[model samples]
Target: MIRHDTPSLMLLWSLLALSQAASAAPDTELTPIEVTASPIPSVAPLEGQDYSASRVDADGLAVFGGPAQANPYRALDLMPSVNLTGVDAYGLSVDQNAMRVRGIAASTYSNLAVTVNGTPSSVSAGRGGVGNLFDMENLESVTLWRGAQPADVGLGMGNLAGSLDLAIKGPTEEAGARLRTSVGGDGFHKLFGRIDTGTFNGGSSLFVSGSTSESDKWRGEGGQSRDTFNAGFAQTFGERGSLEIYAAHNRFHRDEYRPLTYAQSRDLDRYADLDYNADLTGVATTDADYYAYNSQHFDETNLLARFSWALTDDIQIRFSPYWLSNEGERRVGKTDKVMVIDIDQEQYGATAELVAELADQTLTLGYWTQRLSSMPPPMSQKVYAIDKQGGLVFSKWGILADMGDRAYESPYLQLSGERGRWRYGIGLRYLSFRIPGITSYDGSGLPNMSHDSALSMNPAVVAALSTDAVTLDEWLPTLSSRFELTPALDLKGAYGRSVGNPWMGPLYSVYMKNRKAFQKAGIPLQQLWDDLALETSDTIELGLEWRHGSLVLTPTLYYSDLSDKQVTAYDPAVGVSYLQSGVDAKAYGAELEASWGLDRHWTLIGSLSWNRNRLDDDIRAGSAAVLETSGNQVPDAPEWLAKLGAEFRYGNWNLTPIARYVGRRYGDALNQESVDDYATVDLNAVYRLGKVAGMQSLEIGMSVVNLFDADYISTIDVGQDDARPESIDYYPGAPRTLALSLSANF
Candidate 1:
């Protein structure tokens, strides 16, 4: 009999007490960690090569043993608490990216709230919402929190489900390098390399990794492909001191729909059956008949440093400085009717923290400050367009504007630790935002003609804010607790009044558009671009965790009450959408995750998360705020998401299979029409042969995706057709895919 007694569970009673100590640092994602598993693996490389290289080696991971599919998000979406916004297994979209979590995405561009070795990724295209989160070449281990979370998250607004944390591989042990290549269907090809050296004394050697990938689109007129480059290096100064550096550059190009219709999607998909999808795309994209086209070029760079020193056994100090920069430009064909952006963000902070273990309790304290600033684009050009048949006419309207410059400072504190059977945490935070004139535009470049998208042609679109308040300021408080119930079980709970200032992304502000654009006259002019606002919410979560040998289970329940819930809506007249109206809403959910470590030869893991959110009221028409979600489930939020998988290893052979499930959702919030539910099963296998007499280490693997060849819609959204007839829109999934790769280590 297992007695759920306090004394019997004391050792397993790990408590996290909250603190307001200036010594605090940002909390990371909750990646279900199996301490019993082998420590993160690392290896060395050939001499004269860039050492300090390590790989999570997604290639060899049993999950990807099969071929690549449309779901580029892949294992990233299967991790605990992880969810996707625009991802559906084998969906219509080839990119199959664009994501959100909890209930919202980090920004419109789908930038995830990511921390690479404790450094936040830059989301500003040019001082605001503009890019993606990762380059497979630079990724180490991305730990996903998947939903309800701790405070100190979200550079701006966030989702209701979960979060993800990415740890770019750094110097671990030995010194080594690697080079690999692979080619697959649809013109898919990948090449990459890496090297790393273990930590040196209090300091470690450096490491670097980079890769490039390109693939042809399987549908539409013009296909698409992309290239990315990444590099990372890190080392420590003393036992408590360290330095990490990283940088990335990406260039992307894609053809427009070439007038492809929603109905024709299935026709293009049919090409997959004949093994000629990519070929069809390549043929349709010739210069003679090419009509519409879009291509975007983006560049990003980042740098960070963290240093800590132990003044005493119970006290320590830490400091960090980070800088990021990004710039992007987009154009349709040869027209200068382009969108340009440039952003540079930086942060510097210092902290003093104490961890004192007393006879009866442990105490913690800390404090810190930070500052952020943004700058709009530089000199720009407005071009006019004239088509032979006037089919798709474009012209520069006039007066380009820029979102004004602004910056802010924040101070924070916290206290947490364990005292006997009780562990508690409490903290406070405050921020200030300053913007003299949030919207600034030049009244130049007006073409002498009329166009529907005039305002959009201005190239420089700024958020509309008419506030005399030089600074937006706010304060917040939080609390948390945990208790050990039995040696094999523990209970934890947390509540906090957390507030987020809008980011330069999905979060919007109300604005007016030009008549003849997408709106009617007399519409309010509340330009909705990303803005700064205070979002306060109370969150509570309870968890029951258990561990037996290598078997582990964690069941969690949570609720969130949001005040001024920032929702995004679109406008027509101004040709814009903004984060304007917010209402009261509550989100509650439960998640169960378990992994049974049967034996070295057999093990199983599975997880499921469910959430329900209710809006307090409905949104009005054309404020560009169309939730259309009256009395229906929230868009992009599914009710139930689950996954299960099992793996068995024998001698040098391994076999595994996985199943994924996604519940149905309404095409619109009103729930008038519903999308059917879907599920997928995949298979994988790997055989590791001992090194050849003259060879070091070598491996080969095979993977199959969407083994069943099922057709399913992963996402559906509110859309309107000609005459503005309200309708739902959906993105199709990719067809089944297969991949095989061979690798060696020397």
Candidate 2:
């Protein structure tokens, strides 16, 4: 258990004991101190292919700032063709953060495949997503792919946009312990510690880490808190095979910041400090806006294991299996009451990969499969009444259901070779999806009761209803080539196809609301579901790389043809809106990145990108009416983005400053509700203290985020391009904040 009341005092006592012990010990050789320049992000091809990939190592993450070091999504803010935004300095608000790669946005249902240590992760996009699972201190590097990915890399339900791979640091061979603590603006405080057990007995090593953090909202009345624990063990079997196991648990709770309208965001001077109501009124309707009523909670646990063996000198096999358990609830204040949304999910999967060396070429074959089960279908809602004493009273069930079993399968193969100055590769992947049917309970007229109790009271078949299942499959292929023009220059190109899962959440909601209407019309709802197809994209890209003594430059261009995109359609027979997959889209973009080492003490990196994602034709709103969306850009997609950063080191001090700009964007499909462009700057400084209290190393860091305090709309919550103005939401960016941290290695 964590001691929340006196964390600082406990750490101080521990350090004092270490200091007294060191003073009495005999003289000994101290570890050497290294003050090297910070590492810059590397934007290069992947495995001799032309895919635009970027990698940020441990040092690179440090240069991005302490917040970036803690948040994986924030670490990609300065990378080319990526955008990330949040409301808190520490990125603890999981439900409010937003991320976009290229022109694709990631929301509750994102189309980006995210993985950790080569295993599928973040299967559910809501409630803090991937950031809540592991601390950045446990990560060695983060790699991102912008365009079409290789056959073996993208392994999940959605891969149409991109993929993010996180590599965790393994147990070290030497025994050691590290401790870190930080205090920042808005009553923020955090403590983290890790211990590594050196190889013992035979060839086994173990590691354990834990952290506790809490912070007050920058502009609101409430705060956020989180606790995490991680453990791992590894063993080597005489160099022929290895086994590893890892486990993690996290619990997060936060009071969300309220969003504003387009007009409200424009008047920053008057509305910058506006937040959720802190005091409740006697009137139930007025008290519905209370800050305590609008809060969220997330609790999750995960376990993963890997085994590898070498069959021969030319062949090797590896298998990884993972399991995840997640439960969360979000409470929102309504006009007269509070609504609670709950999710309980369990996911289990495995991946087996084999590699063989044949002649001058390398071949890889892999298969991946996963099963997801939801006891109460994700996002199920319940209503509650507020008592005069400000307590919650159970009202009624808003949505209740048990989702059927969902399964996925994929088998992929890839081969690559290098001949002379030309290198090439070809790959193919087959994907299959089985969407779960749902069994919904009739709770409209019933009180808040357990599932078993409700069923027993009803004692009739009319209490529950079930739907038919749907199955879909697709084939994806990839081809890539590279030609060396000179020792310092190279040309590369690639072509691939990718797919995205359909909008199932909205579809299920529509069906539940209109089940009787569908039955009356002699439509089983499966008729509409059977017509739904997965979104697919075929992309082609070309690029060139130029490298010199102290500078590296790369430029890339890509175009994509998208089919069966998810869109909303109005059905007059049911007099309701339903999700349909028939829209087509086209996207094209260009990106350029440059890195230069000005001198041994300084390094600079800059990037610029221009993207255009537009509709190919008009959208059908009804059987006879059409929405004029042709030639219009997608909502929330910026046309231009630019970033610049520089790092300088002198003796034991290192300073880094970065600037970013986001171009204008529209809020609706009709090209109305335009948002203005904005720019912001940030600075971070670190000073090495060598050794203290017998510790091998010590460092102090200071960071100032949003240095200029520029006010702008950071994220817009609009799922549909043809959304109404009242439904669109605008979230303001975080204000200027400061943080200080201390780290020690013993």
Candidate 3:
């Protein structure tokens, strides 16, 4: 349950502790501390790193228009080789947004890993990261590492592309409080507040924050609301060590929206709701609205504990342990035969690192281990039937499906060292997964046989039964190096191999639903199992970085080869869907980013990326027809992306203007349907009032998005083979919108 008084209680407890510590300590003069840099640094490339990485600090984040509901990931859209869709004026709704790295598809984020304070945030069931759980108002920095990840970071299972890391802000040296409130278009309103407790005599500090936001749907009938709370405490144990603990809780609810077809968008109203259909029996005709009943609810909580100690003068050790839990439910479709999904998951992990100072080199060794268990039960219920008067009649309840227990154990080791101007690293990981049980209802609304009867009935059933735990393992390795030839120039290269495990949902569905059905239709179970394999990839890249007095430039070229790419196929003969490990695929790309200080008060930033991806061979379709997809562009993979922005600051005011462009893209593997290129512009301004009235700080900001009201497709449902205009699968982009916000700190 969401508690509005939780933040207040936490703040009260922190103050009480602070008072006691102060009363018990001696009266000693406080030492003065020197500050060298701003609390948040500007966006910059990582020096002495072999791979491509970019860091955006708090100041850098402000350049992205300072939306009321800030989303750190949205700021990465300006970076090279990154694509984002469905972003609104506030840059919120991370779950609704789709993010793509390089030429990879956005349906699943298994290729990318996301972390907060070294804790893994991605769901164990391949549903991307827990982005909605984070309180963006408390973030200090967000870093994006493209391509290969560092050896010491091993908190994810399937990280073939790279990782995104977010760090939270630390407590201030002096006690302070901040509050921000905003109202904008679409009935949008938000309230955010934070409190910081300065260090006490015992060298301890704490901070607590909370936020609540709600907004009406921009182009639909429904809306969304969210509540979040975050807290952190740190204690110092003299110069030997320190301990820090952080926790966050989030509750989110939203109504799902139905996508529109091209014909509906062009002929009917762009925001029309056509999600109503007649009953199957044709006995009573009433409004069976899909959108009216479609909704989702999520609750997530996370806790992390970090401990550091200097074992000796030459050695230091750090240990971090984290725990996370999530509970969610999604309801969709008609009221009569509504589909409901309940997911419950719990995960815990720890990472230990040791740094040793050696002659001419610094050696680092680390180990990471984590365990996850999840239970997802899906059911379809005939709650009620629609009547002629748009009323409902009651019906019976029955179970549809259930997955008993899913678990994973991941462990990895990392070793790296730096000597002089050359640096190198290596890493290895082993991943294991298991699923224990499953249950599904039959056509007559009766429960199927249990594990004993089902296994005895058919020998093949024994191998496919979910009750029999199955385990799969894989080993991953990576190597990278960097060379600094001059003070202003550096060369880097890396080779990495990564793996993507098959998702448990698809695996359970295929084994429980398709295996028996296919066997009844004369297909062997062994053939089905053999067709599924783990997805693997090998990537190689070379990069160059050149820095001048007031300008920084980086260009990188990379190539990747993928094998055993998992794809879904339908068997016409058996009327069942199954997974197939298709042939090899390849992708090559180039990315360039440049930042220049036009003058003392102005800065220019630009980025450009080009990439191509294609399959290496042809495959047979459901109708037993050979489709020549070799050398054809991958579905939904755009060819070009560009971004440019300029920032100007004078006195207490700053203004920013930004533009983005995306080239044409194919919607199908056969390149039959396509969407045209589009561009957008945005402008933002902020004014700061220092020590206004009795307040320590005050600021106001406004942003305008889609300045020209461009009409284009923001995203598309790929795999469409037809060329009919009505069959075009696309999601229309948002129109022009404006937002304003005000904040005060005391």
Candidate 4:
């Protein structure tokens, strides 16, 4: 669907054309400015990244505390253009947490990519908790890209919105041990320990860590529990080569919270305590609402390695390989029966790059490939029906498929250079996908439904479907440049194209539920499957950074034109929601961040962002009706966001407080069913104990979440942007909670 003569290309070329004229001017050397004081948890564009990027390190996570073993998304809540919502204060609920970047939700079709140490994790495909693998204590840095990313980065499934990468802190050079304990309201308890072997003979080190945590839901009868273990080993190979290997395992179980309707959100005092029934009524229909019947369990393990060597002083090569194993099950109590979904899958991938330094320029050739079990959900799910007596019966298969040559591959080349006051990079990447084909079977009528029993039973074949063997490929190009306009001022611009793989969640859902309807309407499922296309987005951005004395400021503006954007729309003939493409969208926004050191004891930070995302046109609702959805704002995308915070330091005591505001947003495509805006304040304070109890250092910390006891809607569960008002569900924000922790280092 993309053409070289499009206006998007014209606009990009016009801006890039200025680079040729500017390169002709004589280059001048500019002096760098030095700032003595800055805030502890600060956000600013990364230097030399050639994009709208920001990074936060360990110090930032320490100053902005909520949970001792917080997830990766929680660590990035302080960054600009990031909105994360969780039903619990500690971010313990894996299924209830949601994140959005630049008006695009992370779990749906409009999604961004997430990586761990520059490699994509299989758990990040859907609404999975991939961040739980490495907690804040083990993370070295988290980098965020809001616009265009370099060719060397990994884009899992999609990157139309943005991308985030978490870097792990490997084995330390010194031998030491650390211990931590925490206790909080609602029966919360956690313990963490780590031991580092330090560098020994011939430059080698090893480390291991483990944690156990549990917490009770504030407004429900159930709770959440989790256990995690991580280990790493590193060794140096002379002076030009090094190797490091890391492994992580995590398991968790949690009871889900009941969702409320629009009427319930209008009056919180009466419906605030509404939840799943604590005890079963014994009646088959009533027992379906039992709290214990609606829960989930997940267990995942990952192993990754990195190898690097220098063939020569000017040339180097690197390789990264990873393996993932995941298995889980979700049980939800329905009207008359309990539906259980079981999943088990595995994935393997690697990335290789060759770099050469030529004079003042650098050239890189990179290739990445992965053989995945499946796309997105990344699991073959089987559905079951359970009765009130706890007797399990096979109902139907949610999704069943074999790995038939399903793989992803990308090759890229980039050239970058810095000359005097100008820095520039040009790159091109080719992405190709080999979607798997699937076959459906009629299993509901079988007497024996176990995996082994069902195979021998040989249930009738219902239908065979697939995206065919067609290999979808796209050519994406990027251009970026940064110019030092003055000694203390710099200007930056970037242009790139990003794409998303076809979403199969809705497609499978509709096919399983309404296969007969397709036949009645004289439509072929194969035709519908073949019609799916990859979503694409073209973006352009301009920004500037200025520094003076003890203060720094950055402002940016960005525009994105999306083509064939995926959305779940209703099929009137079948009376169901299905995956649909070819929806055009336009998003434009502006962001600003500032930091100032007023004095030796006081440092302040603030940020503001505004986004306007809308549909460019309307589409057919049925055979004869038009939806009239043009010019409507995207659902759940808040237009305005603001954050303010300050840190105060005095001797051994340090205190920080921050407040965040999210503007109103709609729940449906027509801009109806609006949600109210809300603000919450959080505080963190830490005290150093110097040397005590024969330990090198000791510290005590206290954290307060939602300090004001704010009562507001935290997230909306509409399933899709085009959902009707009656189908909308809301989750209330948690009230004020307190947590205290103690740590010691030896």
Candidate 5:
């Protein structure tokens, strides 16, 4: 059904058309034309910033061999010192999706700050809730700053790791529409469409797009479904001034999958979920029924507006305002003491920046502020009893658990200047946190007489669980500088101090009405809060950059000291988990990246990273015992990582192959259990069809991931009590997969 020589014929026709246009006569009566001088290269080295950064443009994004419906984070894995695991080619059915930077370990709260169009996108500490909010079809580029965040970036928390910025695509100058469809293994399928309105109505344009996707689990017993929409509008006002607005909404639902222990994974059939029969009793059915009766649902909406104006020939001003809302819930089986966790949040923020040219130097001043609040309604849990059929039986009435209003206000200021071969900048950020109050009631939204009677019977517990209004404040600062060594090289360094505030989940636990239950289990409630402290880190970095005609190389070395690191420890006596600030640690590493353009049709890219981390003090499990983790390598910190890739293009076809290697890692702070290293290869190809049967443009592509089908551990449950042989701690990587996609533009 296809011809190999058709591409050559199309190319011949295009050359003939261009030649004919060149031979046509020009209009002699037109006024003389004027030419303007060319501007400087946009990618040139900056004078005032000292940090490791990378950018993946639209053209580079197209070469990724992952699934068609994969999230943006999947592409970031190619960058230096970045790793993501526990997802298939489609980036769905994630059992342990975790992202780490440098040598830092992933946590319940994320350490990285993620943003879209200069607006914060991450709603929690450990994850980026907005990573899947927009369709990839509408993205222009993704930029990552690895070590120290820029002064102008506005994030209330989680900036200690780094930052990721997503820039949205702008409307095209010409009107057009596009449709795309994809299919792959594991019953995966997706459909997407977009429309762009050309410039009209006094230099204004608009675009809108939507997509839907669904896929069967690659190796588990469940599946995932997602729907998303995006819209944008841009308008030009006064000379050298413009305004733009963007909005997005997304909904996601998926079944939950738990990890497997090393012993259980020996039997591949039992790697994902445990099997159980309803007729069994007294069989400890928690793990067996977890997968069958657990699921999660999420809904989010984002709105942002940006404005830019040129006040004079050498002065400019910019402003951006945004609003976001999120609603999420997780449901579990009735066998557990807790049944559900519901979250509702609202956030709004604004940023203003001014730039001026004075005394042959560029100066910048900016301010950012935001308000965030989380207000969830009352929650309840019921007592469960097993029936003869092995099903859970619960009473109609349930106990109440209400989380009160918690809010925060963040403001920051930054100043920077660049002149000749020198650049410098400094910034300061302040945070004000408030916890108002807490309340409790029955499942029917009324006072629980039984709970009140119990509290009266235990007066000491009542006094300990009383809520109080509290406020906390913190300050952070950063300084950076750069100097040019020669026309082709530069030297840079920076020093930064940042803080990580305790998330609301842990703070709210201090006022839990069920404190008596935990105390009875030997997890003293007062001890959990007595040692709580804000996490802080100081970092120093030095780097070198060299650039030539078609090659660029960068190498960076850095060290970080962390104090009062937040950690969670298991209490075997209570059979529960408690939070504490347990240890001080240090991390040091080197990152190297290079790119060479062999020719117009051949290119090569590679990167290498080496890291080392260790605890400076012994880890204390509780007041009476110590884990003896002093001088031990931090868990989950890999010593070496490498990536290599090449691209080739000829006529209408393009091909790329990439390889990644990960070194061995430990699963516990004491280095008792080690996970083996692994490597994977991926290949991708694309062909373009020009002006085929009334279609303006058409493209077809195929991708193969994990070409060798390597078996490896995708991620480990860090800081686990490895002494327990039954602890499910490892997630298996996905097997080899193939996918195909097609798109048409008109």
Candidate 6:
């Protein structure tokens, strides 16, 4: 049968014909592109590896490399089941356009807990923010959890759905090394490679990667660019254990775009240059005087040691200890704009976990500890950098010594038993926090003299603690059960209660804390107000999965009753932005997913979800606005979401095209202004040719996002007096984008 992805099929046929025409002169081997790279010819699950759920490597569709986005998570922005929220200015930098399954995030971007081969994507930021997305070039396989969580995993802040894991290739997977280089659309270039070799009793792997890229900011007033470096290694130690170590560094040496007022967008080009305009409206057409800004510069290193002891054939135990260190600095343009310079930061921490299983039951325990410190120069020495460039330059002025140390231990006791076809388990977790204060960054410069202003201030935090230090916490308990009603039908349910301790980031505003320091110097102290309310919630999930001949389906229903919800508030009196205690809230939703094997050459998959959540009490932050829309649909939460796609394979050919839909969402929780819904389409393909051509593989693919140009708003900031809901200004989604890429293997 003919395929809907005719273009991909055509490419596949052409490639096969080309290979037939080329005659190879006999001595060297030619590699195929689609063949996966792995050195170990024999495979077995490594003992003590905490591998669990696997995620679909749906991101295999990206085509663009370098200058254009060429990574997996970045390419899946329009994939089905994903509600990537941000659309307007600095979408990548904002946390709103996050990834989740059934509306449940992995807590911070890295916390989602899917273990493939045994590593989880770790994010340096918290749930309220985003950092550099994972680099896809280093991955061997990517898989998302189908929903049944493993026995050894736990979630404290963001685990409700499942997790996604990636299994990177080991040196044993390949006997030699491979390297690639690319240059592209944005002023971008990158070089990366991997090498593997086997030695006495085991194997070793080494990898090095680096890239630099930048684009003229859409607003034309700044440069949206970046540079990055990552390197790592993994090795085995006889039969006793295996160890892996890695280090990564990223620098967002780009320009900062000040969020604009509604009025600004109405007069300037979407992302234009402002310097050419005779009038200054704080808006650029396509080109303008841009600032040299630096927000996050990080140096992170990690080490993992896995050990196991076999007590007997039926019983065994394993322990894992890990360590991590993070150091970064932020600097806004000392030129055209006054920016926040992150000149002070150095953080370190470690975590450990142990697992044991006897018969059908399993027991596990985990503990985590952390420390953070940052010291900034005094403000009197840094106000000149903010006026002309409007940079977040104030970041260089605050200091914090939050002898930050937080520790938590959760132990799970699981019992496996069947009663009339029912299997169940009970779990109890003891969690706590002792995080000291966190530093804040006030983008807008502050007046050295006493003055009343509305702004978000980075507060200086100089305190320390140990054991569950960030959020207020107590012990938590949970229960889960499942019933196998029939061979093809199973029902599972869980109910639990958890709390979120206020992360140090929201606990102290450096600007507010420094007010006392300023007042001591004859300056007025900003009036300060902080909310320290821990969120306590009850959650229940009921789900069912059914499998028939060629089809598998699953449906899950969830409800959460919450109190003291946390949300952002900008204070005008002290010019600070802080997360304050909020009124009660309720969230209820349901998710449905299905995958069908139409035939050996084709398969169909789809997912849909609906949500209803709102605040029960009023909430307000800063001079931004009063959030009095009680019972209003939550901001950034859509009422309906759906995505459908199909995959087809013929010989060495593969083709996939997907469609996704997002429902209308309230732009603001307190206002009637709204963001319209949108639909996007994408396509991708890959082919392999090694069986007849020796040991070589080649892969070429392309994808088009926002296939149809759709005008939609990602975010809207209209609270300032000069801006209002009635304004036509908005942050626009991207125009149609096309990407292509090629890869070869030996």
Which candidate ranks first by lDDT, i.e. highest? 2
Instruction: Quote the positional error of residue 13 for candidate 5 in Å.
Output: 34
Residue 476, model 2: lDDT of 89
**Residue 287, candidate 3: alpha-carbon lDDT:** 41
- What TM-score against the true fold does each predicted structure earn? 0.73, 0.93, 0.85, 0.91, 0.83, 0.72
Task: Tell me model 2's lDDT, rounded to 2 decimals.
Answer: 0.76
The lowest-lDDT stretch of 10 consecutive residues in candidate 1 is 44-53
What ranges in model 3 sit over 4 Å off?
A: 1-41, 106-109, 122-131, 262-288, 334-336, 375-410, 435-467, 507-516, 521-532, 570-577, 717-729
Model 6 lDDT per residue over 399-461, tens place: 322233334444444444446776666656555544343323342344532211212244332
With a 3 Å backbone cut-off (N, CA, C), the pairs that clash in candidate 5 are 109-125, 109-126, 110-125, 110-126
Worst 10 residues of 3 by lDDT: 32-41
lDDT of 5 by residue, 1-746 (tens): 00011112232243334333433534322122222322111122222357666776666666651565447666666677876676556775432466667766433233566678877764552222333777777888777776665566636445666777778898777887776778888877776777788899978999877777777667556667777778899999958899999988877776655556766655545554342222234343543254444566667789988999999988889898888887765556544332554545667887777878776556667666666655322233334444445454554334344444445565665666677888776777766655444444334423333433433443232334334545656676777778888989988887776555554344335336446556677554344544455666788888888888667777889898877776555455554445556557787899887776666666777788998777787655655767677777676667888987777665567677889998987767767667778899988888776654445667898888888888777776663222222443677777788889887666
Cα TM-score of candidate 4? 0.91
How large is the C-alpha RMSD of every model relative to the true structure?
13.1, 3.2, 6.4, 11.9, 8.7, 9.5
| Model 4 spans with C-alpha error above 4 angstroms | 1-42, 108-110, 125-131, 374-405, 447-453, 464-467, 570-577, 623-625
Which digits, one per residue and each the tens of the lDDT, describe model 4 over residues 491-608? 9899988876777666766776787787677666666666777777788989888888667788889998888876666677776557788898888899887777777667777778
Query: Which candidate, 3 or 6, would have the higher lDDT against the true structure?
Result: 3
lDDT of 2 at 391: 69
By lDDT rank, best first, the candidates go 2, 4, 3, 5, 1, 6
Clashes of each: 87, 1, 0, 0, 4, 76
By how many angstroms RMSD does model 5 differ from the true structure? 8.7
- Pick out the ten consecutive residues of candidate 4 with the lowest summed lDDT: 1-10
C-alpha lDDT (0 to 100) for residue 531 of candidate 4 = 70
Output the number of the TM-score-best candidate.
2
lDDT of 2 at 64: 68
On lDDT, the stronger of 1 and 5 is 5
What is candidate 2's lDDT per residue for 271-296, written digit by digit as tens? 87888888877677877788888887
